[model samples]
Target: MGFAGAMVVAMAVDALLGWPSKLFARIGHPVTWLGGLIAAIDAGWNRESDPPALRRAAGIAGALLVIALAVALGWLLQSLLPPSWIGIVLAGILAWPLVALRSLYDHVAAVANPLLGGDITAARAAVSRIVGRDPAALDEAGIARAAIESLAENASDGIVAPVFWGALFGLPGIFGYKAINTLDSMIGHRNERHEAFGWAAARIDDVANFVPARLTGFLFVLLARKRSEALSCMTRDARRHRSPNAGWPEAAMAGALGVRLSGPRIYHGSITDEPWLNGGARDPLAADIGEGLTVYRRAMLLLAGLLAILACA
Candidate 1:
């Protein structure tokens, strides 16, 4: 199947080049394009005046439209390519901007370096770019926990999930998945404006990510030094999270690193009292963020290796 080959090519290209700043400045990235589309749809269709049921129905229609458009565009592009190995390579290159491999590394490393230098100020500033929590309230342990959790969860969201879909149905699959994810990120929340309007987006995102999230957790468990600990923690604590899919990777990372994560934090001026994963373990420090990144790297490499093996077979 072209699934393995196409995803491998996309991952390799993204790792090597990282969608250079110059190129991004000129044309922006594909995800940004998707975001813009989602924003436009949200603004137009999701009316606050509408009843809850009407808003929900509109939201569902909007989501289906975006997904259909993305899949259609993907099919059109894929069809224009030469029907050979070159087509697969080209598809991967086109898919490169969709994968956020290098960006994830750079983002987590930004938090870790400043944190290791004892610059809590700068570390908090860096972490705010990736996490939604109130950065000012975060001390060293809080900062480390937020960054590590973001890294582990995003490892599934930003990388593995896309690759998993790409590996299953090639271009159209990946494109449709991204559409669902972007819609969820844009409007899928419990706030007054989005609670009803974003229900379908959230539910679809959960279903789409269910398998990929567990696979990402499994990859982390396989690469972690404390393999049994990671497995036990994941099996024990994954379902307790607020998000149906995110807990798998976060719990696995917490158990693998022998640290606790996801206790409680401030979001939008209110405290969300989340239960901890690996709650008995010590709090994670800056060094553990680096260790988390190391495991992330190994898991990604292992995924690539498996893809290569499958491609050859």
Candidate 2:
């Protein structure tokens, strides 16, 4: 199918049913099973006393197997159903599990409302629900900063990347992407335990997200009426991130909002003094977090419109 056709199908499904809870749970519920498989594979490889290259190869092979399983499941389900409205229904079902637009807004609102109401304690508690940071010590401004940063980062990871993959290759693409993302969230890390074992998952996620991240940055620029500088922000800040992909959308969001992001912050009691992006912009506020939500929604709209237009063409 053409890109436009795929997008049209994807968007129509998104609008009509949002996400099919049953389908997502049915298709995605097997990570537990897959995780066990990977654990066994890793343990077997560990006992071999192999070279680092061999161990890395085993990890990559395991990751590939997990991806293959998801794709196969999606394909198998797609084949069994009648082809009448199956494409749209299946696409919707797949997309439902993949996107989290409503959930994202609700999560941010949980923090925004409480903070605006002058209940710092309530606000901290709410922010902690979505962010991994320590909420106990955060003041009003700190809470706002954390919420805004989380929203921007999630714009790329949670929203754009999945949508892009779904558009590119339909359910299989989205499923594959989500599997990689899930693996990354679960095990991909730089900490001592995951540094070596989770290397494959992290690296694959980095590669898979590379183009989507850049595309998402462009989408943000277009939505913000600053298309000219969007690419520049993407180019400049793309390298600033250790992950190689997250910086693209973060920088674009920072530039669009005219607020700095990516500076030093404490994670799990340790401080990461990462260089900041958009340092020249305004200090982030709770209001900016609200504005970030607006930008996120607009970007989603632009994507939907693009999909519709592609279908039209």
Candidate 3:
């Protein structure tokens, strides 16, 4: 099937059926099982290699194997169940676990609530729930900036990227994307410990996200009018960020929201001087995070619309 058709099928299934049948709840659902299985494999296979090259190879091999397994298992499920509504219903239910809209909103809401309540301590704690940074020193603005940054960055990684892949290759592509993404999340760090060990996951994720991130920027521009500047900002600033891919969405979001993002952030007690994007606008505010949510919603709708058009065309 074409991209459009696959997306329609996937989204329709997700919207109507949602995730995880009670029947499978005892096993913690298929998505959880797949993630757990990959995590287990990574735990063992990752230890078998330590040199940068070996570790990188192990990570890639592990990612590919997990994807293959997901595909094989999906096929097995297809066969075990008859091709009536049961097969289609089961597929939709299982697929819902792969998407992450509800989870993302919940995480961001946790951070925003504390900020709205004027509790800096609680706000910082909430920020810590979503970010790995030291939150104690962050002021209201800093916390707002961090939460918005994650919302923008993850809109691509956690939401659009998976949907894009899933639309193209159905269960297998989504499964592969999630496997690589999970590996990246776990090991794709720049710290000394993960710099070598996670290099493969990091690089593969970079490539994997390269298109989706840029597309996210484009969709943002298409949705927000005043944010039209996002197109130019994305073109210019995306390449400037440390990660070859992440800056596209961050820069696009910064421009869309008319604020700066990603400059001089602290990680693991040390400070890394990162350049700012869209410095011409106001510092981001709690309200801008709301704007970010609107943008996220538009992007997802645009994604679904694009898929529908593709399916029909």
Candidate ranking (TM-score, best to worst): 1, 3, 2
Put down candidate 1 lDDT per residue, 1-313, tens digits, no spaces.
Answer: 3778889999999999998999999998888898998899889999988899999999999999989999998888888888788998998997888888999999999999999999999999999999999999999999999999999999999999999998888888889889989999998998998899899999999999999999999999999999999999999999988899999999999999999999999998999999999999999999999999999999999999998898888
TM values, all candidates: 0.99, 0.84, 0.85
Per-residue lDDT of 85 in model 3: 47
Distance from true position, residue 94, model 3, in Å? 2.4
* Tens digit of per-residue lDDT, candidate 3, span 19-58: 5456456657555666687668667876743777887777
Clashing residue pairs for model 3? none
Candidate 2, pairs of clashing residues: 19-96
In candidate 3, residue 289 scores what lDDT?
A: 75
Best by TM-score: 1
Query: Could you tell which candidate, 2 or 3, scores higher by lDDT?
Result: 3
Provide the lowest-lDDT 10-residue window in model 2: 1-10
* Model 1 pairs whose backbones collide: none
After superposing candidate 3, which stretches have Cα over 4 Å from the reference? 1-35, 47-51, 75-90
Question: RMSD per prediction, one decimal?
Answer: 0.8, 3.5, 3.3
